[model samples]
Every structure is written in C-alpha cells, then in structure tokens.
Target chain A: MKQLTFDVAVIGGGPAGLAAALAAKEQGATRVLIIERNLELGGILQQCIHHGFGLHRFKQELTGPEYAQRFIDMVCRTDIEVMLETMVLEITNQKQIYAINQTQGMMQIDAKAIILAMGCRERTRGALRIPGTRPAGVFTAGAAQRFVNIDGYIPGKRAVILGSGDIGLIMARRFTLEGAEVKAVVEILPYAAGLTRNVVQCLDDYGIPLILQSTITCIHGKERIEGVTIAQVDQDWNPIAGTERDISCDTLLLSVGLIPENELSSQVGIQLDPVTNGPAVDSNLMTSIPGIFACGNVLHVHDLVDFVSQEAETAGCAAAAWASEKQYSSTRIIASTGKPGPCCPTSDSIPFDGVANECCATWGSTQIIIKPGNNIRYVVPQRICPDKKTTLYLRVRKPDQDVSINVGELKRMKHTFIRPSEMIKINLTPELLARHQSDYLDIHVVKEMVHHD
Target chain B: MIKTVICTVCPLSCEVELTISATNEIEKIMHNRCPRGKSYATTEHIAPRRTLTTTVHIEGAIHSMLPVRTYEPIPKELLHQVMQETANINVTSPIKMGDIIVRDILGTGVNLIATRSM
Candidate 1:
C-alpha cells in the first residue's frame, strides 16, 4: 500500500469540495488535497451551464460553469492540490482515505482531517418503480444534461419529462433550446416540485404545459420508447379509471429526487441520520465523528448550488479549525428531518383526514408530523434542536387548491398551492419558541383559508 | 436629466430610482436590496463600466482560448463592439481560463479573458 499525507483531504470535487478546499487553504490549512473522480473539476456544474448560480456568493447572476470557474480560479491561486480522475474507495474513522487513480493504482493517505463533499446522486426510475417496458430511450435528467451540454448530443427530438424537480424543469427548456419539442412536464403531485422561478422561466416562459395530479401509468415501446399512458391519480396514488391519456414521445427523463452519496460516510463509521440518510453534524458542520466533516449534498440534498457553496465553506473552516486544535465540546446535535417544507403544523387528530399515521417515528430531535392522511405529502422537523435556531421545511403531498400551514399558535405562510416535490424551508427562530426548550414539537398542514390580497 | 436605472447585481434586481440632484450631489435611492446595489447605482450615475469575457481561438489547438474580464466593469454600450472585435482574434493552448487576451484593449486598463474551457 502506498502512503501519502496532507493536512486536509477533500473527497468529491463538486462545488462543495472546491469551496471546501479553497476555504481550508484560506483559513490556514497548509496542505489540502481535493480528490475528484472526473476528468475535470466542477462536478454537476459542468453539465449545468444555465444561469442561476452565484447570486449569493459572487453578487452576480452567473451560470453554473461560470460560478464554478470563480471557485476553480481561487483554488489555482492557493497551494491546494486537486487530483482529477481519482476515486476514493473508502474512508476510515482514523482519517485515512483509500483511493485509486491511473497514476496510482491503489493508495492510502492519512490526514489530520477529511471533508466528505461527495454530493448527491439522482434517484432513478428503479427507485420510482414506474411500470414500464425496458427501453433504450429512458434516461435520467443528469445523463441527458451531460449528453446535450457536454457531449453535444441531444437525447431526443420529442421529450417528456416525468418529474417536476428543478432538473426536469431546466431540461424541458434545454431540450427546446436545442430544437427539440418538449411536449409536457408530467408531475404526479398537484403542486410543482421545482422552484417558483424555474416554473416561470423554464416552463411558463417556454410555454411548456405542466400536468399535475397525474402520472405515467404505463410506457409503450418495443426497442425504444414510442409513447406513454398517463392517468390522473386519486388521493391514494392509484390511477383513476377512464382518466388515462396516451401521448406519443420517444424519450422519458426522470428528475424525481436526489439522495446524498454517503457510502464513504457509512464506511468511515460516522453516525448517519436515518431521515436524511447522511451524517449528523453540529453548527460547525462537523459530523458525529470529530476531525471528520461533511458538507453540501452529502450532508443533505440542497435545493440550490449557492447553498452548497455556503455549506462547504462552513465545513472547510471547521476542518481547518480541527487541524489547529480548535476544539468544540458539548455540542447539542440538531437532527434534520429529511422531509422538508415551509411550515411545521401539528394537530391532535388520529387517522387524520389527509395524513399518514403509519410513517410516524421519532428519530433524535425530529418528530413525525401528523396531518390529514390524504392531503399532506411529507412533514419536516423530523427532529428539532429545541434551544437552537432551526428551520422546519415541509411541502404538501400534491398541489392543493388553497393551503395554509399552521405551527401551533404562529400564523402560517399562506400559499396559493403547495407541492410535495418542491421542498419548503421555514425559519425556526428563538422568538417562535413559546418556551426555552421543549421535548417535542407537533406540525401539520391544513386547507388554505380562502383570502385574497 | 436624471435617469432612473435598475441594479442587476443579484437575483433581487433592485429598481433604483436615482435622482442626480445635478452634477455632484445625488439622493433619492429606493427599492435597493443590498449595499452593493446602492453603490452600483451611485457609480453608474457618475461613470458606467462593465466586466466582459469572451473566447479567442487558439492556434494549432482543437479548443479555443477563453479570454476573460479584468477590473471593475466597462461601458454597457461597448459590449457589442468588444464581442465583435474579440471574435476575430486567436491565442495559444497554454492559456488558462482567465488568461488576458488583450491588455487595455479599449484603453480602459481592463483586460478581456476566457469564460469557459473549450
């Protein structure tokens, strides 16, 4: 086994890793190594050349590549060593990383601290369990992005995006820009899962119709996707009879969800959050294991790349602090409920009107929010760090005609419609707390009181 | 005449209602999100400049050289002129992403550079 050494090792060269490496170096970490399993750095940003990133950090509306270039340029100025086309096989609790590259077949590196910024992976068709014939035309949104943006190959002429996630909405426009006709964006949930701006710019501006409360029940194709059978779904998610419609299309793109890439985190023996399927960390972004930090999508699926950069900066500074013997003791861990939304509303109702009772379970600081079984999609605050300022994120299961989120006595943020796919963020501040600290908090979603401004 | 301009600094493109208040003195700024916007609005009222980035072809290389922007910003009206002039130029492959294609091209002491890798 080959041995190497660095003051800090950053895994996964995405925006988070790049920002982490840069921040660590700026914060006094002498030797930093960024290991990435790609021919170049920038991770998913390479495929996302669209404008939306860098608003918070650079104070400019920059494209993904442009935003990444800013950080990449910063890395070049520092003494940080970036290892491209490198893969990290495993990481140990002792801060030892096992990796491989063309130059070094297999090697071991021991560092004082390691930053896990491996990012997240897109949830695919297999995860969705969409009933379909195995065809050559189905592709993940990321794969299609790579094809069109980098490889210069359009996935298909006529496309149908099967999820209202940000990627799906962006791709709907991307395909159209490349001269492809995007028929419609079909989302099972009634509310849009993407950002409101994306819904306006990518869909509404481009005139792409968004079908809600619907799903592709069956895919029709032989060697390739010829068409699909879409149907309106009932409250139980079952397809409503006589509501099926057949649309002709050659390709299907899934932008259903994203899951944090935590395989290395698990190998390192870090305490994993059952809800997020990522590691649990404190304010400094240090994971359960000291000297090991996780940031960006690896910590949790972030809605925006700007957040990824911000979170990575925290992780990088924390890692540098750990190396310099800046110790943080007696930390009260705040658990993040994987289910995110704008409001945390609670009601003392059993077999609630539109909520799921079976999925309720307490994990750390998170509580299973109860709602009407049929209406609410997912609730956040899986656990809340009572004393600290935390944000509870949630969304409706599908788009509703009108909705209002109620969290105890506090007034909820009114929304015309809410979708489960679009994760909602609610700032939980000290003023909102009725007491210094509480054992648990209850949350729920209810019909919006009809009101107009 | 005093002109009202919007600041495009961030997503919150604040519509800045600027009152020139004649030659040196100015007041009446509104709807600005951050300090950056307010500063930009004041600066634009006096002297307007923009940062520009475009590609320059590389000799004997399949990919083009990315010439990038330098300094604060250049005049917005000169954008088309700069792009047209830079479109006809080429550079070498040893160039980095932000490498300067021309030094003080418009006598503004600002350099042109590459934006993305080819």
Candidate 2:
C-alpha cells in the first residue's frame, strides 16, 4: 500500500485529462497527477486515425493521433506526473482516490481538488437488445475501428452498420477503402446522429445508402454474423409489419450512442443531470460536491475534440485555483446585492432544514438555476454564479432554420440552423447576469418559418 | 454548367452551388456561409481532393500496425490507386511521427507520413 497527495488529481488521461493536467500545471498547481487506465496517455484518439479533427483549435485538419500528439508533446515538456495503466476503483466525496495498478498494487491519493475526465464508452449490441444469437462477428463501431486501424486486422469482408453515428459513418468508409462492402447505414432517427460533413464525405461521397426511420430487428448468426433483418419503424418507433427485410452480411457494427463513465461520480454522491447522464456542475465546472470538477465527454458527449479541450481547460484552471487557495472568492458578491433575491442564512450556523442553502458562505453569492425550455435538450453548468461570464453548452431537440435561442429575455442569439447533432454554445456575460429577474433561467428555441413562392 | 457541392470545410456543411463556364472555369458560387466554404466548393468542383488515412504494417513495434496519412490531400481520383499501393507496403519499427513511409504516391507529389511514433 502506498499513500500520496497532490494539489490536483485528474482521472482518465484521455484528451480531457491531458488538457486538464497541462492547464493545471500551467496555473501553478505544485503537484498535479493524471491517472490513466490505458498503457498510453492518449485514449481513444490512438485508434481514431482518421482526419477532420483539430479544425477549430488548430485551424488545420488533423488525425486524432496527431491532435493528441500535440497535447502529449506539451505534457512531456511539463513536470506533470502521469500514472499509466492505473485504474481508479473509487473516489470519496472528500477528494480521496483509491486506485490499483500492476506496478503499484494499491494506492491512495489525497488531493485538494479533483477533475473528472473519464470520457465515455460506446453503446454496444447487448445494450440495444437486438434479438440475436451470441456471435463472434458482432462488434461495436469503435471496436471494429480499433481492430482495423490499430491491430491491422479487418473485422469482416462485408458489414452493415446499425447507427449513422460519426464513428459508424467513418467506419463505413474505412471498410470500403479496405476492399470491404458496406451494405447500408440504418439509423432509427429520420436525421443522422453525426455531423453533416460525415454524412457527405463518408456515406454520400462513397455512394452508400443511408436508410432513415429504420432499425435492425434481428441478427442471424450462430458462430459468426451471417446477416441481419432490418425493418422500417412507424412514428411510435415500432417495427411496421411486412417492412422487414433481411440483408446478408458477415459483420454487424453497432454505433448507437455513447454513455459517460460516471460510476465513481455516482458512488461519491454527486448529483447528475438525467438528460446529460453526467454530473451537474456550476459555472466554474465544479460538481455538486464542491472541489470536484468535471469536463469533456464525461460532462456531455461533444461532437468535436476541440470543444473537449476547451472545457477541460476550464476545469483544470478552476481546480488549480482551488488547490492554490484562491478558490472563487473573487467572483462572489454580497448577499444583499445578489440577483434574484437575498441569500439565505448559512446552513452550518442554522439548524438542518429541508431546503438547501444556495448561497456560498465566503462571499455570499447566490447560485442561479438554469433550465431548458422548449426544443432545447439540456444546458450544462445547470447552475451559474452571477459574478462572472459563463458559457452554456446545449443541444436542440429538433432541427430548425432561422431560429432564435432565447434565454428568458436575458440573452438571445439568431442562427441559420440548429440541429441535435451539433451542440450550441451561448455566453452569458456578467452584464447579462445583472438583468436576471428570476431564480430560474429558461432557454428555448423560437423558429421563424421561411416562405418561397 | 452547374454543380452542387456540400462543403466539408466544417460541420455547417453548407450546400454551395457552383456555376462554371464551358471552358471549365468557375463563374460564380452561391449559398456558402464563409470564404472557406466558397474555396472548398471551387476546389471540389474543379478537382476534388481528400487526405487518405489508413494503417500500414509495422514490424517490432508496440503494435503490429502504424497509422499514416498523406501530408497533404491528394487527387480524389488517385485515392483507390494510392490505397492499393499502400496496402502492399510494410515498415520496420522505431519509426517516429512525421516519418515518410511513401513518397510521391501515385505521382501526386504527396508523401504518406506516420501519424504516430512506434
């Protein structure tokens, strides 16, 4: 058994963790540690060898490995410590981490602040519950990608992808380029689950058919995947009778969705947003359990790695601040002048009550709640501290053109189009926060219809 | 002549319509949101290019295969040929990132460089 302490401890050494650790070190965190389960620092990016990454951050189209290398190089130059092949079994609410590794049998890490960057995992065939026999040829799109790109082995000669996700679309092209036939990409939704560019460059460019409003009803195979039975779904998502058709294929790749890795967060009693499937945090990316921050896919599944880096930087800087004893006192205002209403008395001084106190004691700043109204799926940083500007990332329930995103009269921004696949970002400055009239900030989308003769 | 191209410059994926003269020169572009979209439409209409990313066989490395991609996008028409050429190639381990695996692929003057170190 070994014991250690750090100014900041970051879980998961993927893009998010890598960015966070670097930012924390740069922010003057004396001792920062990154724990990675993988043998290498780069996570899924190692297997994601395709281009189209780093467009926003670097202004150049780069492969996932290249994008990751840039950060890995920067991390190499810093004094940040990384624990590779270390699995964090649990994290306590007090910022204590219990982990295990082959080199270090058992270890306990006590940190002043923690950053959760566990990233996410792909949804599998078992999760989808597709009626089928246990087969060897079945694989998730990511698994197939790893097999082909990293291991130099083709999963199958012919394939049928279950979801039109970005990975599935990219895999479809990869298979085709490797001399395999991609039969079809069947998506349950009418619209694609991936970026529009993926639909065009991966499927449309290759002449692959994208079947919408359809799903695989059954998978037929005993030893290996022989084929699949796909069917069109009605408005209610029930398979319509007589619309079922069997397509012969050697492989079935599931690209349904991704779930954030938050078992540790749940175990630590961190409140999670049901919609985002991640911990609900405040403006500083601090989770319900103060001093514990979260970012990247573990916060919410993002379409771009560039956004993940941006978010991780925020968490890293905040964690460093907490560790350096500079915590958020600067942003906290007097309770009397707090927007919405006067702050309630501190919970520690008063008797335990049913209502939770929403005010911070150090500066008496009231926490304002943010709620999604209509068409908007959910908003991150579910709560905001009005002292500084905060960025809210959200997703729409449906696609629309000529629409305005209204934040309860506090802020409004017009967009040419908004889609569920693309996450929207809105910045609420301190000036906008000053006009807050309610405890709850409502965000809704209002679409303007266009007419053509 | 008119060609409709979906700009892959960004996720916006604007559908840009390119009007070309009979002499194969781009005359006008419409419906693009940004300058990059206009350039993408023109280049894609005239001579589409795509960066080819794939794995190549590696010996004595952490992994059996190493990911590689062309330093620059080659001609779209040369993708299949270049892929075929790259398929039969193998490299030894101890390779560094940015190491060129294949030079002047398909006479496109684009070199296939290693994206990872092994």
Error of 1 at A59 (Å): 2.0
- Per-candidate Cα lDDT values, in order, are 0.70, 0.87
- The C-alpha local distance difference test score for the whole of candidate 1 amounts to 0.70
lDDT for model 2, please: 0.87
Worst 10 residues of 1 chain B by lDDT: B62-71
Worst 10 residues of 1 chain A by lDDT: A354-363
Candidate 1: segments with Cα more than 4 A from true spot: A326-453, B1-114
How far in Å is the alpha carbon of B19 misplaced in model 2? 2.6
Colliding residue pairs in candidate 2? none
Q: Please tell me which predicted candidate would have the highest DockQ against the true structure.
A: 2
lDDT string for model 1 (A1-453, tens) is 899998889998999999998889888998999999998888888677666678767766666767787888788888899888999998887889999999878989998889999999999888988897988899999999877765556889999999999899989977875568999999977677777657755787468999998999998899999999999999877899999999999999999888999988877677665556676654456665657888888887777788678678877986886676443221112112334232332324422211211111111222223222345444333433343455554545555556676665554666554555445556666566645333334455677557566
Alpha-carbon error at A379 in model 1, in Å? 10
